[model samples]
Target: MQVIDADTVARATPFERLVPALRELFASGAEVPPRQVLTLADPAGGAAVTSLVMSAWDPGRYYAVKVINIAPGNAERGLPGLHASVLLHDAITGVPLALMDGDAITTRRTAAASALAASWLAPADAREMLVVGAGRVAALLPAAYRAVRPIERVTVWARRPEAAEVLASRWRSDGFAVTVATDLANAARHALIVSCATLATAPVVRGAWLAPGSHLDLIGSFTPAMREADDACFRGASVWVDTEEALVKAGELLAPMASGAWRSADLRGTLAQLARGEVHGRSAADERTVFKSVGTALEDLAAAMLVQAAAG
Candidate 1:
């Protein structure tokens, strides 16, 4: 079996290609079982860790499984919080084909999936953006959204002011008009698209702060305990999700439902429905839109296949 590294995966899947590939994959469909998310006690007596196992397969072709470990405390140590690996196998023979660096696949595919959702939901002239995190995934969001929207200006906000400045400087060096925002709510009010990628148990982006016609991308919260946007963010907004699993797993959605501020019937549709033309997106110029992603196994499989093809 071949071993595919992060650099190889990055080279294989760019947003321009991966976004459309994800669109196609969602349109055509695959067999994906509900992913397993388990909380484990840290043997070192630090913060609790999460283990995620996601699996997906295409008939007669391939099967892929991604194993990811998330340690929130790693950020304090100046290290990445996510460590992941993907194993691909031949469906018929059940033979292992490759082992891939899942972190690269996860970040790219996650960003690409957000971009895919934006293609349908974001306003036609969205150029300014507010990024609500300063992590590995947050760094890629600007480029990903730019693929679909005209994104000209970017503002980054984080709990750590210095970290936000570091990300802003990097984006500035890349020729983007970037700024480090000390006030997140003010930034969200003025931006055309607000993309959040934080791992927060509490709400970071409030609904009242979002301007009309703005697009909100929530990528951080995956468990029932994790939430990035408050219940008001969902009120009266046309909401879409990457998959149906988010209904039960995402706190951003669950909290509102529990509070009677939102209902499951209010959901506009899934990304697949949008891709398949079964649902409409951004029906009005001044409509508020939200796309909540909890990650999906099909995306991991799509990204892994792209890397495998590129490596071969």
Candidate 2:
């Protein structure tokens, strides 16, 4: 099988193309079973580690499996917190096609999915963005969101101020009006789009800070123990998700339900419904929207297929 490195994946899946590709992938269908997750206790008495296995297939075409490990303590060592590998196969022939960098695929596809959702949910004139973290995914969000909206300015807020400043500098170099935000609440209040990709177990974004017509993209929380936004963020917002899995796996949704602040019935729709025009998104100019994503294998498969095709 051929090996596709991270750089190859990055070159193949630019946000301008990947965003529309993801929208098409969701509109069409793929078989994606629930992701398998295992929480591992650290023998060294450190933060718990998480292992995830996700697979998806398009019948008679391609199949992809992604294995990911999330080490929360990696940040202290200045290493990426998430590492992943993806394997692609020809479903019709049952032949292995490629082994791709899942970390790159995951980051790009996740950002693209958020941008796809924003195409329908974010205000037509949205420009200012508040990025809640400075991790790998956060670095690509502006590029992805810019594919759909005119994102001219960015405000970065992170637990580590230095990291946020570093990320801001990179954006500024790219010609964006960027700033490091010491006050998250103040930044969030003025941002037209608030995209959060953090691994915090506690709520970081509060609902009261969000202004009308804001689009909140919550990408960090995947497991039941992780949360980025609080329960109040769900109140009075048109909530959507990448898939139904967010209801069961993400604490962003689970915690709100447990506290009687939101219910599954309150959700507007999934990405598929929006892509297929089965649901109304941002009907009013003043409406607030939320897109909560717990990553799905279908997105990975779609990204892998794109990479494989580009390699050929």
Candidate 3:
């Protein structure tokens, strides 16, 4: 079996390469079973941690399972909140083929997925963006969005002002007009694209602040208990998700799903359907659009396949 590390994954599947791979995978489709998100209790009565298992296969070709560890309290220990690994296998023989850095795969694929969805959903001339949160995933959004759109200006907002400034300075050195924003809603109103990746349990982006023709990409909320956008945000826009099954597990969609404020009937369609032309994207320039992603197993499989292909 082969082993792939974070550096190798970074070198192999840069967003430019990975985004197109993700696009192709979603457009074509894959057999992805339901993803498992388990929260195991801590014996010491501490904050519980989460484990995610996502499995998918291309049938005759390969099968893969990605295991992710979500430790929110790790920040207090000066560690990353998320760590992951992937095991790839031969579909027919069921033999182990590779062990990979699933966190790397996740970070790249997630940014790529956002960029892929943005290509279809965002307006053609979107030049400015607002990226909420200054974590690992947040660092990748600028370059990823740039791959699909002509984004020259980017604003980063985080709970800690220093973190936002640090992230902004790094991107600025890369020649992007990146800045730290004090007001999220104000930043949301001005940008052509608003990409959110915070771990907030409450709404960070409100509907009232969004301007016309803006595209909102929600990437943070994973569980039904976490949300980054208000119900008004969905009510004001034509909503879409990475997958319906994934959305069912996300709190952003669940709140409205329960209240009937935003139901299946109001959904534009999943990214796969949108990719295949089964559903349309951005009918008008003035249309407010929201793309909420809780991540997907198909994306993990697609990224793993791309990593192997790149190595060969």
Candidate 1 is scored at a TM of: 0.93
- Cα lDDT of model 1 by residue, 1-312, tens digit: 999999989999988888988998899899999888799997889998899999999879889999999989999899888899999999889999999999999999999999999999999898888999999899999989888988889999999999999999988887789988988888989987999999899999999999999999999998899999999999999999999889999998999999999999988999999989999999999999999999999999889888888878
Preferred candidate (lDDT higher): 1 or 3: 1
Poorest 10 consecutive residues of model 3 by lDDT? 256-265
lDDT of 2 by residue, 1-312 (tens): 999999999999988888888888889989998778899998989998899999999999999999999999999989988899999999999899999998899999999999999999999898889999999999999999999999999999999999998999999988899988999999999988999999899999999999998999999998899999988899888899999878999999999899989989988999999989899789998898999998889899889988988999
Whole-model alpha-carbon lDDT for candidate 1: 0.92
Candidate 2: deviation at residue 266, Å? 1.0
What lDDT does candidate 2 reach at residue 160?
98
Candidate 3: segments with Cα more than 4 A from true spot: 38-49, 71-81
For candidate 3, what is the TM-score? 0.93
lDDT by residue for model 3 over 132-154, one digit each (tens)? 99988999999999899998999
Q: List the residue pairs that clash in candidate 3.
A: none
Q: How many backbone clashes are present in model 2?
A: 0
- What C-alpha lDDT does candidate 2 achieve relative to the native structure? 0.92
Which ranges in model 2 have alpha carbons more than 4 Å from their true place? 38-50, 71-81
TM per prediction:
0.93, 0.93, 0.93
Worst 10 residues of 1 by lDDT: 303-312
Worst 10 residues of 2 by lDDT: 16-25
